[model samples]
Target: MDEQTFWELVDRTGPDPANLERLADELSDHAAADIRDFADHLARALHALDTPAHYHAVATSGASFLGVRCAAVAAGNRAYRKVLGAPAALATYTGSPGDQLLPVAERAYRTSTRADWQHQTAVSTHTGSNVAAWGTSWLHPHMGTTTVEGLAPQDYMIALRHVALTLDADPAWRSWWRQSGLTACELGIVAEGRLDHLRPSADIRRCADRLRANFTCASPHGGADLSARAVSEVRSMFEVIRQAMSMPGLPPTPPVPTLPADVPEVPVTAKPLAAMPAELEPQGYLTLTQIQEFFG
Candidate 1:
């Protein structure tokens, strides 16, 4: 499925989150994989050179014939379930119409009945900028010898699609994902959890920080450039987030090297690593500056 079809699928549903569970079926001929690949196209297209990138971009990014907010929620939820635990805690938080999600922690309480979910209570702000700025891990569950540097855009799409399909398989997760405001908050959860105990790559955190810092939607030149950058980085970061999260449907990614308990922090001025640990040396994680820089 291409970008146009993806939006067309979403446009038929309008903005109601309630209609999402059945949304994938709307693309009748498409498989779960197609729905996910469509999400990749939609994400890239929404933040295209012509489109604007805003927090609300998912809701209002496209023109009248196509608004992508609901589609983004579907794609994001599909990706979300593959995260570290896909937390049972997250499942408890059913979204609603008038959710007070600002302080994040407050929203967590209102969304979930469980008390143990406090770890994720802060939502996106759960990890302050300083923490992510310090260091991040580029690791995956069940080491398939995966590293963020070696990933392709399709690889990210596959992982996210896996999550979407996984959630689709479970009626409960899909039900909550279809609720109002859950998709947005869930994306926020994915973003905030980047630095959680899952051991995200410091490179991802740095990139995310830079993306937020450089974002300026008001200025013409600034917004255009920022939109372009957001497009690239969001794709890259989702893959990074996938690496940080769990992979469900794909093959096992090879493990990189054993990382130290305290992963070293990358300096802003420093280039990607020139070398990698012996285990990763044979892979481009050693030879390629792009792969080695972030995960080494």
Candidate 2:
């Protein structure tokens, strides 16, 4: 089945094991590879969202090292689309950004012109300057004292350059980045160090990578095309991971709400009083003030 159809079936079926098993069997032996691929994709995602190795990486490599090199992937996507006036993005961001920022960013990444996970790139260009710094700032408040020990000044510089290069496109973002922390000189040195490939003593990346691979929990998300059963099984595994880590489980996908049969269609008053003819259309909409003239 098509991805949308598969998702719709999943939504309507509510992940009943029977439903999943039936779906799985329907695929037949020919589809076993698809099942395994889909399952692995989910298993990997479970590993990334929580798990001990994820934190190990967080402690050494920083949040960016966990996924595709940035925790703000979700936020960047939303902020970029919100800035661009994307129809779907605007609809979702109607309320205050508040805690919903991450989901917004995720959706933005899924829907924006750069729908392929180039979130920081979009956020960098859209907001202008240091997308990394901006993204890192968002992570800072939540990171607590878990600093990446021995984070090589060189790797750090490379990360900073990723952000600093946006300067030519957006000086304002850089101005904002500098305000996040460190004096201008400090930021300058970081930039210079990045240019010079300097290091304080050692680095954190290798350690983090080692721990990341060493952890048996799972791995980062992989492969896009997934069967519904694979999604279900993956999410189920995610539950296991969540329980193990004492992290909150993934929220259950709610079935889309439908209009009740008893509910009337839109009332006449909601529409215009009359449809203007072709010639009369040029007169324009008759506002309340203009319509009042008739009564007078």
- TM-scores of the models, in the given order? 0.22, 0.19
Alpha-carbon deviation at 37 in model 1, angstroms: 2.8
Task: Report the error of model 1 at residue 52, Å.
Answer: 8.3
Best by lDDT: 1
Model 2 TM-score? 0.19
Residue 44 in candidate 1, Cα distance off native in Å: 1.2
Cα lDDT tens digits, model 2, 1-296, are: 23343334334433223343443443333233333333333222223232212222222221222221112122333342243333223223222222221232233323333334332311211121233334332111100000122222232222222222222123333343344243221111111112112221111111221210000011112342222322343334334433543544345432211211222221111112234587663332333332222112
User: Which residue pairs clash in candidate 2?
Assistant: 74-105, 74-106, 78-105
Give residue 56's error in model 2 in angstroms.
28
Task: Report the number of clashing residue pairs per model.
Answer: 17, 3
Off by over 4 Å in 2: 9-31, 36-154, 165-296
